[model samples]
Target: MIESPGILYSIGAFLLVIGPLVFVHEMGHYLVARWFGTKVEKFSIGFGREIAGWTDKRGTRWKIGWMPLGGYVQFAGDLNAASQPDPNAGDASAEERAALFQFKPVGQRFLIILAGPMINFLFAIILFMGIFATYGQAQNAPVVSAIMEGSVADQAGFELGDEISAVDGRAIDRFDELADIVRLRPGQQMQFDILRDGRELSITAVTADVTVEDRFGNEARIGRLGVQSAVLEMETLGALQLPGAALTQTLSSLEMITVGLGQIISGRRSIEELGGPLRIAQFSGQTASLGLYAFLFFMAAISINLGFINLLPIPMLDGGHLVFYAAEAIRRRPIKPEAQEWAFRMGLAVLLSFMLMVTVIDLGSFGLWERLSGLIS
Candidate 1:
């Protein structure tokens, strides 16, 4: 669907964005396992046949696989890359058994499994902090500068110079936060609390759904309340203040995503907008074209999404592993191997089906089928 230079550009951008994130995630697991005295058998970046690799002094086979979609770290005593304990690990030499991942205390095992996602979150925080410290944040107070004539804001009696205090009971400090909330709930009623003339008043209005096209020609419908901010302000974070600002910004993004997901689940938004690798590649290339700051912000966002997705309680994922560990903790033993295998199979099936659906959506978005039809004619 993507042709020539565009295809090559997308591939390069995708690799650059995903490779470092995957490496950071696996490194978290590898480092924590080593800390718990477990031997890592392999540290891999990607899957399938090895393209290139070398052994470390610690005897771990570090390799890059042909498929660059995802990666894993295999621990000694694991049957495969999924970290299933080797059935014969029990019969291993006492010395070898000492370094077996399964032999570790449950707490240490839990920590090792958790370290991967935790590191992803930490990486996002660091990236955000660095960006904020370097470039600072561009912000604007949520003060109404103008009310669109005969629009929702005008109908709701929104006046110029009114500072927004809250939306739907959620306190908003900046104009962007107000925009974020309003954009997701098109045609829905919203309650706005504003401070005007030193008096606070609440106004209720229904948002207007506006269809917009992005630079990539993707169409999306978002809500607009028709009130503009009075003035834009650039707020610079001091070195000492960077951490707090970064954390706040990162958490806000996460919360916004969570709310967006909820809206989709509630049928307030279209699930057809769900995307897969193709969509991700498109975004990667587009962001890279916007220069370094934009690319770094995009990477931070992807890292946060990765961390959150990995924390979902689906088997074959980090969260699923955590669930098993939790069960083992309560029962004083691991779940039956047969049961674990079945859970993983189901999880794999669900993931694959979702991937296929999103891939189809991506192709449709790219007009791949339409182009092929035109060629046939």
Candidate 2:
């Protein structure tokens, strides 16, 4: 029997992770719609034909789709409920068509658009805080662990066991904080305060220009001060520790998204850096192997990504609708329907193109074609 590509296994793994994550995202929109006195028509866990579902007393149909790409929420009084174009709209009566998104008041529409992303952010915070409150956070004491051969850290005369006290006079307590400052430049020189033996030590590390590939096959020559943390010394925290930890995680997530976007836009990174479902499964399986702690962390990161992607100001996206609503609020009138329609079309095209590109990368990353071609070759 031919090997299954571990396809089913990966799919199961991804569904375990993404199904709940996407539900949380869509629920953010759904709950908000209800809060605003709008009726929800459907709450789907996946898209396409409904394999399993039910209608609640509230008259909402909850179903799972055949294609498990992602989930969505459909508000009431709308044909198909999403931004997708519907040929069925042509046959609708004038009153039916009148209930279209474009006909909604700008203020009402703004809340609906804003809710999806807002819920994502809220979920991230809650997850982070929950994790912290339950298990606590462990951090290293800003000590250098390993120095990569020929890396910037090695060349900067950074010896192992040098306890980094600060970066640019900012007292550094965590390795993440140090990484944030270090990765900010590829060739920039920064001051480092270290505690060596018992005395304070002052040093400078010139970030070397080096290229690294991200999760997606994007190349970036970044300032490489290649250093590893000594170890994760377990430091348990009290219940009050959750909020702070949540804030820290939030800032870190924001920094990552900002840096990734900047690198992609600046040509320092390539578009091939994007990965879709397949990649998630690969990582998810790996994370599952590492056990619960790592899996939770991975899920949290993915949650942050979901939030960030939704917040981007693109048509058909939560952010895109918010932009239009903002414009309407300022001008005291809705945007021309044609403009909204055109923007939605363009956004859909861009999103699909990106999805296809990511799928390609996923296939390559998994070496599907390469292995097959090698057999033929």
lDDT agreement with native, every candidate: 0.88, 0.76
Give the top-scoring candidate (lDDT): 1
Clashes of each: 0, 2
Clashes, model 2: 2
After superposing candidate 2, which stretches have Cα over 4 Å from the reference?
A: 1-5, 83-105, 144-151, 159-171, 180-204, 208-230, 371-377
> How would you encode candidate 2's per-residue C-alpha lDDT over 1-377 as one tens digit per residue?
22223566656777878888888888887776777666677899878888999999988899999888778887655545454434355576766555444455668767776777677777778777766766666677678889899887788788889999998797878886787767766677789999988889888877877777644343445666889986666666666777777877887887778877797788766666667987888777666655677677788888888878888888877888788779989988767767877888898898898888889887986788799999999
Looking at model 1, report the run of 10 residues with the lowest lDDT sum. Answer: 1-10
Residue 217 lDDT (model 2) = 40
What are the per-residue Cα lDDT tens digits for candidate 1 across 1-377? 22223888978999999999999999999999989999998999999999999998999999999999889999999888877767888998889888999888888999999999989888998998888777767688899988889889998899999999999999988898898889877899989998999999999999998898776666788898999976667676788888877787778778867877888889888887676889888889888877788899999998888888888898878999899999999999999889988898898898888888999889988899889999999
Give the CA lDDT, 0 to 100, for residue 181 in model 1: 84
Instruction: State in Å the error of residue 335, model 2.
Output: 1.0
